[model samples]
Target: MRILVLGATGYLGGHVAERLRALPEATLLYGGRSPGADLPVDLATARPGPLAEALAALAPDAVVNCAGAVGGDAVALAEVNARGPAVLCAALRQAAPGARLVHLGSAAEYGPGRPGTRVGEDAPTRPAAPYGATKLAGTVAVTASGLDAVVLRVGNPVGPGAPVAGLPGSVARALRDAGPGPDAVLRVGDLSPYRDFVDVRDLARAAALAATRPGPLPAVLNISAGRAVEVRELVRGLVRASGFAGRVEETAGGSTRSAAVGWQCSDVSAARAALGWAPLHTLADSVAALWASVAGAPVPAR
Candidate 1:
């Protein structure tokens, strides 16, 4: 199978491309703003003209759109997160109708689910932030495009990558900065909200499975670990794993503030039943692996 991965250099996209390359029978091509193994097509400024030309030349069997803008003003989020995928779906429908497209959506789309409620694929999407709203819009656009597509409403993908500067990256930074110093004070936001975190390798594999399945087109599936952990607990786990004795301080910043305090998780039974897929790593294991990678230690087995 020939696959085209958009946002090839991104956190999750990079993993997806790497996983595809591991498959001996699969031929992978990367499409992005920069030159890669394949052609360049910027989803941010994608119009039918350039998009059609680029995709037409590659002629992939599957197209995985992992491209997105996470944090920005409302307009910027809409352009890159929402409108970009919509335009790409349209272009793909015209250029390669037979290609199966897997869109990487976010668990943020479901916003904060009620406490103890597992957000399923059919859960109501009440996005609390501009990024979530735009991502939800992208999912809707892809579904309405009348193409062979599947939407994976993914959770927080944590793995070895650049140190994220926001709340999610705080624990990582704390682990990285662990040393004999005043318990390395690390500033954080609300730690009450619970989140379902998944390893990027597992997510990339699920996406590959989604792309290979024969479908009616435009199916929405929630890809998650089906387990919720509070931010405080996650921090404790990371601290224990990395021996990071850190003092976490709360900050009052809009961008770093938690959007909701409810249980934000998903029931990935559909993914398992349909695709026969399950996450190989737990949150604790993922955190340990991330810390080990950051600290240049051997990665533990999944």
Candidate 2:
């Protein structure tokens, strides 16, 4: 199938691009804001006419929007997270008719999930942060535009220097750029919140599958492992994976902002049942690949 992946340089989007590149007879189209893309698509600034014309040239069967503003002011976030997808929806419908719009959503859209309850796709989207709020707004706009859309609420996607959401990027950064102290220290903030971490490869796999989903698909799907992992445990695992007997301390401050969802465990049954997708990589496997990348060593599978 011919597919277009927006935000192709970002972490999740990058993985999706690489995965699609590996598949046979799949025409992959890449677009992004930066200069290093097959086609430039500035979601926050591009007009509908130009965007529609560009998309129409591709004739894509699926348009997976992975564009987002991970950290920014509410206005900036709204532009990329909300208006961006909305614009893309209109453009795709006019240009690439009959294309399925697969938008990547965050579990944070549900705010703080219940500790004991598994969050399903039908769960209320009471966003607690600007990021989630804007994303949910964008999802609503796109889906309500009478377009065939699939909003995949993905969990914490972790890999070597993945992105802003998971601990892998933070841990890898600290390990690489920390002070030259006596101990290999990895300073972090509160380690109380629990999250469901999925390997980026697995999430990428799900996205690729969703691109080729047959017939009419569901409105939303949760792509996750459905397991709660403590934040501290994630740090500890990274330390062990790095083979660094360092002093990993819980510091006072880190990122200035936090996600709406402090605890996230997804109910992935719907995705499995509908999309025929399952995670093949484990948490330890992700941690190993992350450390391997940070250490500049040959990455071995777990």
Candidate 3:
């Protein structure tokens, strides 16, 4: 199987690429703007005609799109998250319509979830911010592209190689900087909101399954832990994993999207039925792995 992975160098893409590499008889192709990528392609600004030509030449059996922007202005976000998928779909339709296209989407596309309910794939998408809105646009493009495609709507991913742009990475960074001092204080934004946190490795496995599975699949599937836990708990879990004795103070401000969506969870039953996939890592497990990877320290045996 010739599987081309875009954004293979990114956090999620990196993990997904690694998992796909282990597939039997799989020829993994890296597609990105980075040097040394097997296929030099930039989805954000890529035009359809040339991209179609490139796709035709590569002739991948599957294309897994993990390229997306999490933090950027409206134009920047839309260009990558919205326009990128649209263009990629157009090119795929022209060149590799038979190849399976697995696109990564965000749970934020579901907007504010009712406090205790699990938002299913069929839930209405009313994104509360530009990030979610753009991601939703990308999902729409992929679903309507008339190609063999599936959009995995991922939740808050926490595990190794977590980027500093998100909470997990930021907290890990802060803990490292603070050291083990009891007097050190770590201040952060509000941590009371609920989130569905999935281990990055688990998410990668889902992507791999979606890419290789035979026959038609649902247009969208929620890839998440299937349960909501307060963000505060995740912070505390990381703190424990880091052996940070300092205090954590929740400040007044944080992600505007978080503020708008006070609670979030996803119903992953469809994923289980379709791909036989489930998140295997607990929050503690994810936090420990994250601390080990980010802090450059082995987690103390408990």
Q: Write the per-residue lDDT of candidate 3 for residues 1-302, one digit (tens) a residue.
A: 99999999999999999999999979999999999987798889899999999999999999999999998799999999999999999999999999999999999999999999999999999999999999999999999999999999999999987999999999999999997889999999989899999999999999999999999999999999999999999999888877889898889788965579899999999999999999999889889889998878774332
The true-structure Cα RMSD of candidate 3 reads 1.6
Candidate 2 per-residue lDDT, tens place, 1-302, comes to 88889988888899888888888968898889777665588888878889999887778888888888878899999999998988888887788768988899888788788887789989888878788889898878776867778888888888765653646777776776764455767778877778888888898889888888777778888888889888778788877665666677787554433433568789999989988898888888888888777778777754
Worst 10 residues of 3 by lDDT: 293-302
Better of 1 and 3 by lDDT: 3
Candidate 1: list runs displaced more than 4 Å. 162-166, 251-258
Candidate 3 residues lying further than 4 Å off, grouped into runs, are 298-302
TM-score of 3: 0.98
TM-scores for every predicted model: 0.93, 0.93, 0.98
Q: How many residue pairs clash in each candidate?
A: 0, 0, 0
Residues 50-130, candidate 1, lDDT per residue (tens digit)? 788789989999999999887778999899889999889888888898899899999988877887778888878888888
- The candidate with the higher lDDT, 2 or 3, is 3
Q: What's the lDDT for all of these models?
A: 0.80, 0.81, 0.93
Clashing pairs in 3: none
Q: Which RMSD values do the candidates have, in order?
A: 1.9, 2.0, 1.6
